[model samples]
Target: MPDPFSLSVIVPVWREAPGIESSLKALASIREAGHQVIVVDAGSDDGTAVLAGPLCDRVLVSERGRGAQMNAGAAAAGGNLLLFLHADTRLPADAVTQLETFMTSRSAWGRFDVRLSGRRALFRVIAWFMNQRSRLTGVCTGDQAMFVRRDAFEALGGFRAQPLMEDVEFSRRLCLVSRPYCIHSPVITDSRRWEKLGPWRTIFLMWRLRWRYWRGESPESLAQAYRSDVRNA
Candidate 1:
């Protein structure tokens, strides 16, 4: 028999009030399906916590950083399976069932493919490349909705305290233990970032950052460059 386990969906948010309601509502089915949802807010003054309070199973406040917030959520979570999700991402209807099935296999870590939400054709190409590159490199991004067994996550020491590329670093460490189950069913994520910033420019910026990271660049410096680029874009 497969290892029976519960799931906890952890969402790390900072100033995401504009979209938090819809995102939490999207997880209603998952909550109803008996999984737990935890929203870790990084001191958002936009009522993100109040708005999410009624929707999710738990609402936590933490220091302002995605990695920190997610770590706090994971520490407080009681489920055997921990799913790190972004505020703007929505899982597919069958996500829980799929994860449950995959947990029966030898793989202990995984992420779903991602589809950017937009009508632009460029978004399709970006999504394709993102999924294919992740499959080839075994490095998953936060947008991909990374999931892991709680025991495995704890053993790996959770996400590193970094401002950027935490997902990539965590995936690298995870691959040391087991190859990730790259689920082909895609999760839908907001494309506003790409829409606000030029799609191709954003893609190139990400690629550049990844290359720099691979070359042993400091995350703080990369994070500063990323914020500056986004602000100036």
Candidate 2:
């Protein structure tokens, strides 16, 4: 097998020019530690690819949809480990090393840590919810930046291209065999959506959706609830 440290960080970007740069910056730092970063563009006409320029090891444009873009990007990546990241989220420092420690030993298939932003107070409750859910279900959102062994990823198949909870579904599939890692170091995610929708209200919406999911509501239904609740920019 190739070295476990041979990892590829994949980011699926749409029309997100503002935050993609931050993600690129963090990925650059990860590259400094010896890892490849691939930006998968989903019809991004807003110069998102242009900004990515030299920061990424590869930038491949794909059809719209996060799952499709990610699959296309991962197909072209040479890394043994595949990390799926969001355009608006930042990766943790030493994430590659942390991942190496886990994958080298085959500790767990893969998982993301908690999600946070600069403001600890604002994210305290959010962190609790995310960490608790991850611990219990072995699931992590896209912001947590999920990684998987390349073979396992292909075996389990990639994301579902669903409007909502594709990450959740992917995690569920991953947990069918064993738990994924919930790394100690968390990644910071932009709180702009929460800020626009009111953190408490946003939390409530997510809770409601999760509850509905637990109650057998479909992921599409859950996504529908949030679709009207917040502005997706």
Candidate 3:
């Protein structure tokens, strides 16, 4: 008999060829344990799909956006549960066990705590605040590796068709169903963005963006501003 509580981990990528293989390889054990790993590429020219093909169960080509790519992955998944993972992030070793506990629970959705892949003390401080803020506000970021039951995901209609803050928007909607079942075991996410802008500058930029987003700014505008800032940084 098939496992009723199987998980499908979806990774959305765009030009992530440099680390795509390693990222998918990390999920090998999950695949071996009867879960599914789907990599959705948003029209990468760097052969990301080719590199990811053998490591995961399926490699899909989708529209050029994280939200669209993730939605495509969710649509193709065969598991009862769906996990939206980033290509630059790696789940903890005990993620399968943590997911099993979530599968047996009544939670509609969940996210893992996130730790930046930097050895600096400031990175730890940043991660601490991020976890605390998520716990307090019931809001989650993509770096956290969000997961939900496939039914709930389908009901919510997957991610919004936005370039940024899709995770925040989805989390707000998911909150209407149930508070996130946050696991303490942290997922390690790349800190290259922070490193690019310097930690404090990145934090302030993000806070400003979120504040504007909350003030009813459009995601397209926010994404443009983010790109400009990152380029200037």
lDDT of each: 0.93, 0.79, 0.94
TM-score of each: 0.98, 0.90, 0.98
| Pairs with backbone N, CA or C atoms under 3 Å apart (clashes), candidate 2 | none
Number of the predicted model whose lDDT against the real structure is largest: 3
Candidate 2 per-residue lDDT, tens place, 1-233, comes to: 55546888899989888877877887777788777899999878899999987889998998877778888988999988888888777777777778878775654376656666647487777877787878887877787888888888888877777777777778888887567866778777777777777788978888888778778888777777777777552
Report the lDDT tens digits of candidate 3 across residue range 133-183.
999999999999999898899998999999999999999999999999999
Clash count for each candidate, listed in order shown:
0, 0, 0
Root-mean-square deviation of every model: 1.0, 2.2, 1.3
Of 2 and 3, which scores higher on lDDT? 3
| TM-score, model 2 to reference | 0.90
| Model 2: how far residue 117 lies from native, Å | 1.4
- Tens-place lDDT digits, model 1, residues 1-233: 64567999999998888889999999999889888999999998888999999999999999988889999999999888999999999999889889988788789899999999998998999999999988898999999999999989999899999999999999999999998997888999999999888898898899899999999999999999999999997
The C-alpha local distance difference test score for the whole of candidate 3 amounts to 0.94
Off by over 4 Å in 3: 1-3
Pull out the clashing pairs in model 1: none
Ranking by lDDT: 3, 1, 2
